[model samples]
Target: MIPPLLSRTILATTLSVIFALPAAAHFQEIIPSADVLPEGGDVTLDLVFTHPFEGGPTMAMKRPVEVGILANGTKTNLTDKLVEQSDKGAVTWRVSYNLPEPGAAIFYVTPQPYWEPAENKYIVHYAKVIVDSFASGEGWDEMVGLPVEIQPLTRPTGLWTGNLFSGVVTKAGKPVPFAEIEVEYVNDSGIKAPNDAYITQVLKADVNGTFNYVMPASGWWGFAALVEGDKPMKSPDGKEVPVEEGALIWIHTSPMGK
Candidate 1:
């Protein structure tokens, strides 16, 4: 038996360690400085792998395997433009693009399979976001033809904080019924979660793979719908590891009041 005071101290320390780490809800963010392009239709994008709600404890992201844009029914390879950066001692990527014409510019990335020690598997999030410029929003709904993607039913731009954002979860070019989606608000500052459960909100797609969520605050909110890839990939140790294919969409919601 141990002394009562010492035993209570040990238990308190153990519980702190247990509750310190929030559940693993990693998000691959393709966040643009501005959702809609300004006069010259120019915007810079920040790409990172991390728990967005916590704004920290970032994970390593390799240089994307593929990075490009699909606009006006044409796909342009922008892989050479990515500039690597570091934050919180983790590697991330960024790029700057100036839209030449006024069409719905859909920027996307296909990152190399990342081996996550926490999950014990490889993760690949095919992330994308739309930046509308010069009032050209007609083609914002076009699909990128990815293995997993979220097709926005609502225009991905010009959204208010409390607005309802909806999208269809598609896997392999088809709707994924009852898919699992995790929501996280980018905790830049001011906004916070009191507990781990409040950090990430989980939702299930309807029969048609559609899901919606209302933004609680004015900031960037990331939606990631996870699905198992059709094929498995090998881990760092050469053992066959399962793959998690995520369809991620990041949108910015503006403040509705002072």
Candidate 2:
């Protein structure tokens, strides 16, 4: 048994460490069942707002403002097809799309502004992911023209685990110099982070708004380039609050194996 004063001191120290730990970054996930459809069949997409590395405490998401697919220079609205899902009391969404043609399908989502009380602001993440159908090499680099977007310098799909993924952070079709990007892998393999710093990797783009990262593991990785919204929005409390605008892109990698 420990003395009362010493025990109290230890408790205070433990609490301080816990409070100082960095919070896991939130990623707007638009993960498809398969990034490459060999025969151009149906692919289901799971849209969840959560900390991908931690893989828990999924945040509630309202019905998205827009959901669409851009393929072959054509954009089709899929917002009406979203099916609501719930995970541990948090609202999520899913949709299935058929890709009959041989081309790259760019799926994007504009989520409803989420009010985060802890940050005293609203978050609107414009997220997108590319799915190549029938191994079509064409149209892999088409821009969706989102307000905030990532233009891939390297092809977004058909990547090996060690391949370096590079892109430019753009806002309204213009490069955003020195943008900050947060990266997290979908921790499907139950990989534990040694500490808070390993949970999310953060990096800044170059003067040309370009950034790159090598995927060390085989899984879906999300890159979110964060910036402030052009204007503040009304919060749930009726207060004007700044918005954290994130241009997010997800890519998948596979190991070289039999």
Candidate 3:
């Protein structure tokens, strides 16, 4: 038999050591093994930890971690960094890669579970994804709801109106002007054909988040603006620009002086 106070002290110390560390370690999983590479499009990659909400603290060995995507063994780092699940003690790292054209790419993360007591920090994770060019109508416009205003142009062919439009993209009721706007026109058939039905003119908003584009010719047009985001926003043709929600304004050109 031991003294009562000593017995209580020993029991408390044992409990502290037992609950000090994670019960088990985990690895990450890759999803959508194959992804469509939009012409000049940006791709987002998600690295999911087998453990939930293990973003930082929940990782093994408390190591410095990095996640990246690979193309033919060439690696590209993702920007999303790491995220943790507070409730479940799981973690995830999200990353983005730019795909110039359709091809194959591999992805992985490094230096995970970088702590001591070796048994807990046992898993290193990596994976791959298939990239291919996507057909039309399978891009950001499709991913997010495209606002279609499709307004008519006010001028004739090749005539510069010196007229400009003013507006700003807003989220949560705040103006967001740091974006790119493109005026796109559809063919007479009302369908943007793969060959020659789609026409576009790219422009940028002013300091006040305003723009003035002299309507050149018109069928149907809209404003494509870049919104606030983590990864760089890209056009269908793959031009890197600010990302933002867009508005579609219809334009019908008159025969000049109208």
Query: Per-model C-alpha lDDT, please?
Result: 0.89, 0.95, 0.40
- TM-score for each model: 0.91, 0.94, 0.30
Off by over 4 Å in 1: 1-21
Q: How does candidate 1 fare on TM-score?
A: 0.91
Q: Lowest summed lDDT over 10 consecutive residues: which window, candidate 2? A: 18-27
Candidate 3, residues 142-255, lDDT tens digits: the string is: 111112111212221122334444444433334445456655443333443353223445577656565556544433233445344334444444655443223333232334
Identify the superior model by TM-score, candidate 1 or candidate 2. 2
Higher-lDDT candidate among 1 and 2?
2
Q: List the residue pairs that clash in candidate 2.
A: none
lDDT of 2 by residue, 26-142 (tens): 889999999999889999999999999988779999999999999999999999999999978999999999999999999999999988888898899999999999988779889
Q: Per-residue lDDT tens digits of candidate 1, residues 72-141? A: 9999889999999998999999999988788788999999998887778889999999888776666899
What TM-score does candidate 2 reach?
Answer: 0.94
Instruction: Name model 3 segments beyond 4 Å from true.
Output: 1-25, 32-34, 38-40, 51-64, 79-89, 114-121, 133-258
Q: Rank the candidates by lDDT, best first.
A: 2, 1, 3
RMSD of each candidate? 2.8, 2.9, 23.1
